[model samples]
Target chain A: EHPLWEQIGRSFVHHYYQQFDLDRNQLGTLYSDTSCLTWEGQPFQGKAAIMEKIASLPFQKIQHSITAEDHQPAPDTCVLSMVVGQLKVDDDPVMGFHQLFLLKNDNDKWICTNDMFRLALHNFC
Target chain B: EHPLWEQIGRSFVHHYYQQFDLDRNQLGTLYSDTSCLTWEGQPFQGKAAIMEKIASLPFQKIQHSITAEDHQPAPDTCVLSMVVGQLKVDDDPVMGFHQLFLLKNDNDKWICTNDMFRLALHNFC
Candidate 1:
């Protein structure tokens, strides 16, 4: 497997760990120090800030399964798409999500520059 | 090149032709017969409806440059990201756009199921 593929796989595992146990340390390394994580225009910047925000989430447990994965690569950058099935709060299936990850290669390591996801939960409203 | 790669390249060329001359026909085939194209919350469904919407765009001439491309593939689907530089309307350099394409392969051909793009134009406003 290409190094980029390994990085992406690692990122997903890290996400699973964080989601299952609310492990802040596992989640922190996935993002850059200056990275920004936004949901519905609310931005959380930096590792500490992002961890704090995630730790504050009311969900007790999360189980995410990647139903599909796709990648498009240009030179050193790649975009990853995952159709995610997530179990959140009360262990109920909240919604399906489509996530887009924009990654760049920095010093032979892949780092996610932008991550955007949409939930089917909105359709229920 | 894999068949999937060819399909992706063809899609980009099709996009350029549509953009350059306001060609409605070229634009219509890029999407599925039951596809949905949405910006903000406005959704355009089906081919004829989407073409009508594009034909209404006031841009006279458009030039688009793809600064980057990336792909991720799983089974039969792939996601593409294009950092597009566009010259639109009145020959002004309006802004850059990041376009995300979610594609599915049906019977050996690829069709875009969803397309999302963000314009730097919004940042200026």
Candidate 2:
């Protein structure tokens, strides 16, 4: 395990949720204009499209409790992070979730190139 | 898009479903014994664990129609494939799904090292 890669993964997870909760606009800096997000099977390309999808979420507030995570440094300074967590959406039942991120190290800064998120419900939530 | 990688992705998607439908036993050959799988959030490690999880699925039969896919060749001869598709499970409502595979090219043979699968549904279905 690459310690530095794992550190980046942890920081990304922490900062993403914090920024998202404080102000989603702040989270835009974490992603590039060309970044893409896969929400289950639907695709959202570009930060503008990603923000639109984020804003359309059914819940007004959400919390993420990361339980397990792993990271792998890929070629071309790319990093793959897999996170397993519990999601609390407003007052709803705590939901299980899995998120994968492909990050690119650009100018000593890490930027998310691709993100994928899905619920853990067997029946799908 | 890497043409060869994309071709591999397509073949992997096709054969995975075909073999899974015919005989789950055949599917085990595609994954290494130490392979890991993330179903939404929960984790399944090792081929035995993965097969157990697959066998426990509620659906007796399932069909996968891959609609979109992307493949990136990573370091260490690993290929990352992201797939978006529609799933039909024993006459259940057609479900949208996203699957990610981290495959390692071992002597020209692609073996899945990490697999993730999730269904797309807004509410618990």
DockQ (C-alpha based) per candidate is 0.04, 0.15
In candidate 1 the C-alpha lDDT for residue A13 amounts to 45
Instruction: Give a tens-digit lDDT track for model 2, residues B1-125.
Output: 54586578668877887887776666877887778787865677788899888888787887778766666554455666776667888978877776788777767788888787766553333
**lDDT, candidate 1, B1-125, per-residue tens:** 64565457556645644554564447666677765454432456666776677677776666555544444332223444333334345567555544566566667666666554444332211
Alpha-carbon RMSD to native, per candidate: 13.9, 6.4
Off by over 4 Å in 2: A123-125, B1-10, B13-99, B103-125
What's chain A's TM-score in each predicted model? 0.67, 0.89
Q: Report the lDDT tens digits of candidate 2 across residue range A39-120.
A: 8657777888888888778887888877766665544556677766677888999877667787888788888887877666
Best by TM-score: 2
Model 1 C-alpha lDDT per residue in residues A1-125, reported as the tens digit of each score: 64465457447545644554655446666667655455433456666776677678776666555544444332233434333334345556455544566555557666555554444332211
What docking grade does candidate 2 earn? incorrect
Q: Each candidate: what lDDT?
A: 0.51, 0.73
